[model samples]
Target: MAYYPAEVKEAARGLYCKRYSIREISRTLGIPRRTVYHWVDAEAWGDMLSHEGVEDAAQRRLVLLITRDDKTKADLQEIDRLTSALERFQRLREREQAMRGEPCETASAKPEQQDQRGTREKRERKGGDSRSGKRRGRVIKNDVSHLTPEDFKAQLHQHYFAYQRELMQAKHYRNRQILKSRQIGATWYFAQEAFEDACTTGDDQIFLSATRAQAEVFRDYIIQIAQQKFDLELKGNPITLHTAHGPATLRFLSNNSKSAQGYHGHVYIDEFFWIRGFKELHKVATGMAAHKKWRRTLFSTPSAVTHPGYGLWNGDWYNARNKVKRQQFPGFKEMQSGILCPDNTWRKIITLEDAMAGGCDLFDLNDLKLEYGPEEFENLFMCGFVDDTNAVFLLPQLQACGADPAEWADYNPKLPRPFGNKPVWCGYDPSRSRDDASFVVIAPPEKPGGMFRVLERFKWVNKSYLWQVARIREITQRYNVQFMGIDTTGPGIGVYENVRIFYSRATSIHYSVQTKTELVLKGRELVESNRIQWDAADKEVGLAFMMIRQTTTPSGAMTYAANRSESTGHADAAFAILHGVSYEPLARPRGGCRVVIG
Candidate 1:
């Protein structure tokens, strides 16, 4: 532990006993604030210490004199004789005052005694702090005095306090995991914990962050806290404090397995799940801390199950639970049981729900729900884990209504036989840049309210707006297209205008939050209800559908688009189909007659 020099320590004690603040003592001592804190033991050097010590010493001396000194015993006998003589002398003085018409001292003291009793009874009736129901237990209050300055700051946040209490209360765990909702202040809380440990302990501690910017942020916070709260300035490079006990240093580094090499200290891994090569980093960190009293904490808001942190949290428990459930029941949904921490490790999961319930005001749940939509908000803010290996459209769901690519390729769009005399609708999404412009033609059902099927699909790269419009015009004329839904967002506006001039049946859809949302909703509804079918062997089409992913913004806005893979394109094809579904296909084949049942 870092400590102050003898002179500085003396100065700190003097100022502290004089009721000077810790910051004031630190400034006077010209030492690091934390060092001053370590040197000034409040319990040992409180407000009444000197007076109580002097009184105790006098009493002890009196006892020793009575027990071991005959001379002192004789002196005490004389003192008692003098005390009785003084009492008689005082009584004689009072009798003389009464003869002179002066009031007796006893009469003056009676009401004072009555007043003291009345005050005591009144206090008892008031019940002190119990009436307010805010009385804290002595033990709990005592623990606060043990906290370092930075920890005291952390206590101001209730969630952090509760988290620390849980960790401290656990008997068997040295390692801890904090899976928390985003923006819930876990980073700040742990940073304070690390700062306190570095300031108060002789141990060398390492703080790792996901990026250089983040590492600097964590480091800057420590320096700021030291300066603002303790009047300590951490100057010079490689930030080290030379103290009476030893040299204490806090080094911040970027998150990497290599950074952990040849370092021995408590390890703080911030945003552990977001770090690349986290598994390797974890291995290296644990190995470095294996021989020492070094402790490690891995914490993050969850992402995909592919993240190494998720595996650490769920893998063991999932396997064990899976085995037991399979034995009990032949079939069961695969549900992750709970986090199974490693030996001497603790795991805690705190969601936005928990934080809000605990009266945390950092996040508005309704806003986040709208921004992230259900799936993303649930994963990031709800402390819910997701497996995104099959992102968006699952292969099985897509394959249910999928047809063979060979059959789809054999049926030419020029022939009228394949369309089955049904009115065909085309959905168009145009892109002027590197993204491919895609269009899909759908064949409506032969009967009323029947499923729609993909008749033909095509994507054009480096195609001119005029060329795309010509193709739309040609398709409209060849297939006698009933209705065309075209995305009028960005470059699509020009295409929508030109196509409308040639093909009057085309509808321009101005893409906005509501429109895209409705498009995705309608697309999903069509798929789920088995109202739409596509060719299975069309890899580009499948990839486009798979790329459709939704994202939420911090301001509580949502957007949906393809995941954008180099192998395929931005989900223009998927959006086109989504647009096609908006027209609803009229739900009747051409030349079909409706009966008047009523």
Candidate 2:
């Protein structure tokens, strides 16, 4: 409807409010004076035009205050008087224009030379400096400063992956978690925004990185942005800068978050996923910010699914992302708004696939695939929560070999053990204190190397060594176990000697790094080949499978063990099963049948 665009019209009104002549507006806009005058008279521009006089008054008063050589209480009061008169003048000017048929009916038209003279007067009053061969009246004006917020934001995301821009512009910035691909510019974007905010506001920005080196890098970047855009040089022990509003500080700290208390400001935790003692550090850092209602943005690449960060990312926030109604955990409960606004913590996940599809060329997918294996790359850049770094078995492979619920129900420990002529093998893992001793009974396939179907399982805690031996004896006699493998570590040695005193078929398995590796490899072979099926519905057994982790030594030797969490104690149940399957029976004497160890 209007001749010029909305922003141009707003800028025109703003300049007019600053007391720019119609001719000046025309030349600036590259439009004719008649067109400018015509729009300034339109009903649509009436509200803006009336407010222009008020804005002009305020700007004049503020400029005068800034230019004064020595400002006093009386001067400040006069500035306030000018501010209060702004609204009254706007109304009076509007009414006078209505009666006179033109805005500024009594004002004289001035020459272009007068505008230049007025600017020089203000510069002189403000004690302008000429050391750089330019008047000090105007501050730094970069091309980027002219861009609108939306324009600058869009340009910032040109190199971003598909979902990255969406994530950056998300309404939620206060409490946010971003699990992203490596080198995706997420940290860079946040640092830029934080520094910009600090330059314009007096708020302090606190950044806690995984290491001192990382914090130093972020500090350098923020300082660089400030210097480039504002021509401000910020340097010191703590990285301090003086902004137009006041003194703002950007403090960078490493992973020693325990000493990060007593600061009320914007908090950013970088590389959170890999931070040592992150669970404790997160509590300390976030807890300090929580009371002050400070903004918090946590950034990191995905780590093990067992990580606490993973639980936070996948728990309540994950549910919200899927648009599902679910119960929330502590600190994750819905805000009173429940409208998914910026005040709420926003969770964002962006993987390499999303980046590649979004036109990011920083990384070649083929090259990454070769450098890091598919699983490793997926975990690192694809935002996958899989424990590819240390997992003995992938969750997917384990799922593929999962037994149906009905099959598992049939083998319930509460039900009587099934009778069969099939050769039964037992793996025993023994622990005396602070751990549970467990055993898994498995039936070999009808033919060799076919598959092992786990039929029964047993676990006990706080039992005497003799009691465990009695339990083993009962199992061997009842199931007619062909070959039994038992752990011979610590108390296990006594148990093994007692078992062999009665049962010749039993074999003692010494605990060692090599022996453990052999058993874990055998289990891995079964899982990879889909040659093992176990009850997926059994939570205890399933948890054991999940806890299995493979650690690689610097010497290239690999070791297998469970990541015993407080919730899931030692993975004796898992080792018990592996030991059972490790048993191999010797051929019976030609005329004799397979001997049962009783």
lDDT of 1 by residue, 513-534 (tens): 6676677776776776777777
Q: How far out, in Å, is residue 52 in model 1? A: 53
lDDT for model 2: 0.61
324-394 in candidate 2: lDDT tens per residue? 55655333223211224332567666677666676777887775554333444566687765554456765
By summed lDDT, the worst window of 10 consecutive residues in model 2 runs over 139-148
Predicted structure 2, TM vs. truth: 0.40
Question: What's the lDDT for all of these models?
Answer: 0.58, 0.61
